[model samples]
Structures are given as structure tokens and as C-alpha cells.
Target: MVDSPRIAIDAMGGDTGLAVMLAGAEAAYRQDGALRFLLVGDEAAIREALTRHAELAEASEILHAPDRIAGEDKPSQAIRRAKTTSMGLAIDAVKTGRAGAAVSAGNTGALMAMAKLALRTIKGIDRPALAALLPTLGNNDVVMLDLGANTDCDARNLIQFAVMGAAYARSALELAQPRVALLNIGTEELKGTDEVRDAAAMLRQADYLPLQFTGFIEGDRMSRGDVDVIVCDGFSGNVALKTIEGTARFVADLLRRAFTSSLRSKIGFLISRPATELLRHHLDPNNHNGAIFLGLNGLVVKSHGSANANGVANAIRLAARLVRDDLTRRISEDLANFDTHKGPEAVTA
Candidate 1:
């Protein structure tokens, strides 16, 4: 029997609930025997799913959590009710060292609330941010932070995001000099709102990260893969994320219409089938299935609720990789450096 750390999964969180979670855990365990799991949610549902996928019974176990944190629940209220939810229980497991990490395809706000209220954030990490990542240009994916965590932030918060994000980029993405940039209204120093300009100034002086600190990146430039870490307030960051998702859908719909509109266009699409296949693979959500809630005391991954088995499996694989890499320790050490190289705040006229 191969022994490995087990990941705690909130089986009740996603849209498909226990079924998809079970399939994911089973598939992952079969692929990598070293991966064990704890499905934390409604006991009866978990047991039923387990029977349906009985071969993984030994490698996986169920931990009952009677209540659920609804996706619509306010973050503040969810934090108070954290103990009752499966995601909260899973986070508790990680905190107690019973699990290597926690995986949830549930309420994003609730997960953040539970993790912060239960597991706590590392010192110097003012507020934890969600880095929803996907492959960008140059085989590099950008880490955009505060993705619906804290709506308003100060300089120190943005600085912490950079430090943690850089460590993640280095460890996860293998980027030697992950270029960190502030997401702003404009690339020029003078063109953004007061908050963005001030944040940019702070990042320029805050020198804790091993990653290269680039100036500013506009939202339009995000697709160009201009920066490795994109820092912004949660409000702006969430907007950017939704915009990207919407644009991808719009483009795909447009492509389908273009290809099927005429026989000549269909023939051209067939001739270009290889390149099209490559592009589709590159843009597939399943291929980029996990988002890391960084700065938490331990690794916590959130997958889209609509994820199929492959997506859930990918999330577990991501958590396992993060655990083995000792990501939390590395991030802590790097965050400790924030006080070292930080210069006097830039004087803006």
C-alpha cells in the first residue's frame, strides 16, 4: 500500500455535488495511487457515491459535515457559520494536520470566509487573495489577485499579494523572474485612478519579491501575457476575470458562426483543423482547472462548480503538487522579506 497525505474535499460544494466529487476523487486515486482523500460533506450522500465507485473505498473516506455554506451567503455570516459547513470542516482538517490540503468546488466567498476565519492567514499577509490563473501568451499564465476577496485594499495589501503571488509563480509556474505588475486603468504612470497610481508607487518601492517588478499593465494587455502577477483590488480583479471569461465565450460563438456560415468557410476550418485543435486545447477550462487561495495557512484549491471528473481530478493533483512542494513555507519565508528592501513611499505630486 502506497501511503501519502490525504486531501480533504468538500463534496457538497459544487453544482453537481457528491457525484462529481466522487468521480474526481476516484479517478485521481486510480491514476495516482499515492493520492488519498477525505470527502467532507453529507454522510449519506457521500456513502451512496462511494458505493457507486467502490473500488476507491479504501483510499478515500468520508467525514460528515451536516450543513453547507451557501454560495449566496454573505462572507461575514458564512465565517461565523464556518464550523457547520463541509468546506469549513475540510479547512479545519488541514489546520489540524489531518490533511495535506483542502479542495472545494463550492461557494467562493464561503470558502474564503471559512478558510480565513478557521485556518488563518500567514503573518504579513494582510488579506488573502484568490489567484485565478490560466495560461496566457508565452506558455505563461498570469496570477491575478484579490479576485473577489477584499474589495478595498491599501498599499501593504497589494505588496503582500505581490510577494505571495511571486512565490507561487516561481514554485508553481517555474518562472525564474516572474514579472509582477499592478493592474491599472493605464500603463502610463499618470493615467490611472488615485488608488491604482498609489498602489503602483508602493509596489515599485516594496522590494521583497524575487520576481521582477514591472510597472503597470492595462486590462487590455492581460491577454498579451505582459505580466506574471497582476495585482488589483477585488472589485477590479473580479471584473477582469469575468471579462476574460465572457470574451472567450463570445469569441468561440463567433468562430462557430463563421465556420458554419458557408461551405467555403467550413472547408477552410477543416484545412486549419490542426491549429484549431491546438487552440481549443490551450483555451479549455479543464486544462486550467484550479485556482489557489494564496496566503492561507495551508493550500486550498477552488475548482469551478460545473467541473466534470477531469476538472476535479486536476484540482486534487494541483493540491498534491502544492503540498509536496512545501508552498506555504516558501511563501512565508519570502513574505518575511517585505520589510527589508521597501523604500520610502514615492511622493506623488
Candidate 2:
């Protein structure tokens, strides 16, 4: 008997299907006493998984969507015609106000298409970007938008991403007026392709420019603590982000190999166990498991495709918190008043 508290999760949408997703729901319920989940997927599979977790079984509600959005199918076509797909059901739960948020790690393209077609945008947002919240140094984090949504973007779309990303930084990261940086090869005005240069000019003339804009953030400065939001086309942002992720994993693996190389190295590892564990946990992608598809009418989180139970649970919890934060409303309000916030007049992006 789930009452007002509910989260819709695509239990059959991930790589491991209902097994991992049920484990995640159990974890989320254990972590937060007030949270309840509305699991969506194949009924038989979900029931069997829940039978293993008594507590979660008692608090969860299962909904059968009857179909799945396969990883290879084209999102546009699949979303449009796959009426009984799990992705559609989970999103429908939010659209009908039956659930607070939706979580999935299935085919991202399918999820995005279904969500937009179902919930639409939140007034000002033209193209909804998939904004991934990356963990930064200190107690803060920055917002990176267009993670893999739209490959081609104009000057206006980039600026919109800046504003939306800044607002997300403010509400999500609690920044006063988040420093928004355009991803570029160099910080100089003369640098970058014509597209980036044109975007820079458009951003410079923006009324919100003085307060939010940070000119350009070069590839080397990505880890710097100065910027709170980085805006770029989906193609560039996704490539740079994936590169960083790959590098982090590579470094961690190299360290692991070194630590286990010999008896002497093993002894040294014993001495540095705590420090090494901290670093390993910090670099683990599962530790930073959840990502937001920002600019939608409601909050949604996409976990990794290969995410395990703990990762899935973490993603559900992340979506629940974001839904509680009123992120959609906050973003809309902030962008609505961009002209009054700071440099040039308001322009569509």
C-alpha cells in the first residue's frame, strides 16, 4: 500500500533486469525509511526478486509494463510504438502524478524520447539536455549539460544550456551564482572553431553573462574548482567526459597492479591500505552513479547500464532527492529572470 510516497523505477530496463533493480529498491528503502518504490517491469521476474527481500517487498508496489525497450532499437521508433514498454510505464507514473520521480539505466535515447513525449518541457526549455552531475573536489560539484542528447547545437542552444546549467548549479549545488564556462580548447577569444567562437560571442552579449559566464574552460582546467557549470554540445561534452572517466579507471587499475606486484609492494600496500581505499572509492564510477536528464518538467535519473544493485539503489535515491528539491521549478524561475540577473538582453538558446 504505497500512498503519497512512491518512486517509479524501470526494473527490467537495465542490463541485469529485475534482479539488480530489486536489490536497488531494497537498498533505497533500507537507506531512507520514508521512501517507497513503485517497481515497473515483468511481473513474474519482479515478484521473484522481491521475494528475497522481505522489507522491500512490504513497502514496494509492482506494476507490469509487459515489454522492454531493447538496447539496440532506435529510440524514436521504439518510444513511439512500444506502448507497453517498461520505460514508458515508469515515465507514465510521473506524468500521471502517481510517482514523484522516475529512475532507469536502460537505453538512454529511448528514455529521453519517451520522457519528452510524455512530460514535455518545463515552459522555457526548448531542447532538453541530459545533464550529468559530476562529483568534484571539496564539498561541491559542477553541472555538465548536453552529455549525449543533441550532437549539433547553435549559439542560442549553447547559451540556454549555460543558463539552465547555472540554475541547476544554484539549486542542486547551492552556488550563489554558479560560474558557467564554455568548454573550449583555449581561453583566448581567438581560439576554438567558428562555432565555438560564435557561441562565445553570443554568451558574452547575454544579460546573464557578467554574473554567470566564466569565458572558457580549457580541457586541462576541467578538474579546477573555479567553475561550477560547463556547457557544450552533446558530442563534445560526452567525448571529454567519457575520456576523463576512462582515464580515472585506467589510473586506478595501474595503481592496483603496482600494489599487488610483489611481496614488498604488498607490504607497502598494507601500510597505505586506508589511503588507497579512499582513492579507489573516489574513482569508482559506481560511487558517482546517478545522472540527471535536466530541463524536463519533472526530475529523472539515469544510472549506468552495467550498474549493480548498490548503484541502482543509489540512482533511485538520487532521483527521489532531486524530486524533493523542486529542481524543475527552481531552474524555470532562474532562467525566466536571466535578463534582470546581470550583461545584455535575454535571447533564446
Candidate 3:
């Protein structure tokens, strides 16, 4: 009987369609009993899925969207059809105040495009960055942003990202004063490009901010958990994100081969099964399934297009958390300070 925000789901937007979406909703409801859902998709298909998930039916409402945006659809094309697409309708629900947040396991680019158009950027934010909680050695996850949204950014843009990222950490991580850093080739102030250095300088001078700017962080040190939030341009951020994911997979595959290479190795694996199980749980992508489009006037969480039920549920849970935290409002208040510190010229420049 915990009352919480209602979330809008693009039920037809995921790879597995109605069944997976409904299953994810059910799982999320079980995890967070406070959740309510607005399932958007073809009514008949959603109803069919509901038949298989009675618990979700009681906690959900159906909103029919006959059209869907395909994986290959361009953002331009998707935005044009936003009024009819399931993804678009879900975003609209947030803009129209019917839902607190929206979650979609759809085309990343299209979702970004449609969300930017519908939600728009919060005042003083020139762009929105894709941010997510990356598991770190520390007990908590680190916030990394500009995962693939802008590709290229200026000093001002990086500064904006830093502000947005800090706001996110405050909301999602519940940190009163999150330590922030800029990703650089080296830790020295003289290292890295002009944009990163400039962003660092601006952050250092912003005395009014709540977050602590700890200066430059080398790429190699990202997982050490010393920094609470990491800021980078999209190109570098995307590369770093992919490298982490690839490395994780490569290690997993190597472990599998090593464990099965011989009978003695297999025996050792069995003896160490519990430890390996813990490693598996920590490395699982489903545990960190939501990538938030921060800086938008309304919150939108993008699920991995191929995410399974568990992954989708994690995404939905993330959306609900952001809603309850009032992430957008927090970002807006901080963004205003960012503009004040930078002045009109620096912000517009």
C-alpha cells in the first residue's frame, strides 16, 4: 500500500514486445510495491500480456498506441510520427503530467530525438546528456554522462554536463555533496584538451555549488570509486563506456574458457562457485539497465533495446526513483546557478 508515482511504459517498443514488457512490469511491482504503470501499446496485445500477468493488470492501466518506431528508423522520421508511436505517446504522458516519468526499450537515437523534442531542455541547459550509474569498487555507483548524446562539445557544454551530472548524483545516489571530476588523459591541470581544462576551471570557481569539484581524473582511475561523478564529451564518454563493457565481456569469456579447459580446472571452478556467482551478479548488465537522458524538462529513461524482463524492470525502477527524487526540478535549480556563475556570455558562447 505504498503510494508512489505512475510510470509510462512504451510496451511495444522493446525487442521482445508485449510479454517481456508485462513481465518486467510485474517484476518491478514486486520489487517496489509502490509503483503504478501506464502501459502504452496496442490494446489487444497489452491485454493479452496482462492475462498472463494478473498482478500487473491490477496495478496498471492500458493506453493504446497502434504505431511503433522501428530499430532502424531515423530520429527525424521517428519524431515526425511521435504523436502516434508508442514511444512518443509514453513521452507525451510525462509532458502532459499524466505520468511522472517514461521508460522505453526502443531505438536509442529515436528515443533521444523524440524525448528532446517533447520534453525539451530545462531552462539554461543547452543540451541533454545520456547518463547512467556505473558500478564501482566503492559501495555505490559512479555517475557518468554524455554517453552518446552530443558527440562533440565545447567548454561550456562540458560545464553544463558537469552541472547536470552533479544534479543526477545528488538525486540518484542521494549524496549531499558529490565529488565531481573531469575525465582527462592525465591528472595534471595542464593535461587534456582546452575544453576539459576550461570546464574544470569553471567548476573550481563556482563557490555557490553544492558538489565538490575534485579536478581531473584519468580514464584508468574511473573505477577506483574515488570520484562520485565523471564528466566527458560524448565521444570520449561513449568510447570509455564501450571499453568497459567490452572488457567485462572479454574477462567473462576468458573465465568461462579457463574454467572449462580441463577437469582439474572444472573442479576448482566448482569449489569457487559461490565467489564466481557474486562476480556474475556484479557484472550483470541487467543490474544497471537504465540510461537517463539528463537535462530534459521531463525525465526519460532508455532501456537497452534487447534488455530482457529483468533488465526492463531495472529501467522502470530507475524511472520511478528519479520521479520520487524530483530530479528535473533539482537540475533546473542547479542549472540556474550554472548560468549565473558562467554569466550570459559564457553560457551563450
Give the candidate number with the greatest lDDT. 3
Question: Which segments of model 1 are wrong by more than 4 Å?
Answer: 1-3, 206-208, 267-274, 341-349
TM-score of 3: 0.97
Q: Residue 127 in model 2: shift from native, Å?
A: 1.1
RMSD of each: 3.4, 3.0, 1.6
TM-score, model 2 to reference: 0.90
Arrange candidates, best lDDT first: 3, 1, 2
Cα lDDT tens digits for candidate 1, 1-349: 1148689998888888888888888888888888888889999878877878987788887889999877687778877766778988998999998899999998887788788877788866768889877678867878788788889877667777888888888877778879998888777899777777776777676554587889988888887887888888888999989888899989999999999999999999999999999998888887788898999898899988888988899888888878877889988887666555453232110
lDDT of 3 at 195: 88
What TM-score do all the candidates reach, one by one? Answer: 0.90, 0.90, 0.97
The Cα error of candidate 2 at residue 285, in Å, is 1.2
Over 1-349, each residue of candidate 3 has an lDDT whose tens digit, in order, gives 1158899999988677777878898999999888999999999988887888998898999888989999899999999999898999999999998999999999999999999999888887788999988999998899998999999899888888888899889878889999999999998889989988888888888878889999999888999899999999999999999999999999999999999999999999999999999999998888989999998889899998788899999999889988988889888888777667667677533
Provide the overall lDDT of each model, using Cα atoms, as 2-decimal numbers. 0.83, 0.80, 0.90
lDDT of 2 by residue, 1-349 (tens): 2223578888888687777888888888888888878888888888887779899988888989888888887877777754698888989888888888899889988888888888888765678898877767756666788898989987767877887787677766767878888998889999887777777786676654324676999877777677888999999999988988988888878988998999999999999899988977766777678888788887778988998888888788777777776778777776667645532344443
Clashes of each: 0, 3, 0
For candidate 1, give the lDDT of residue 231.
84
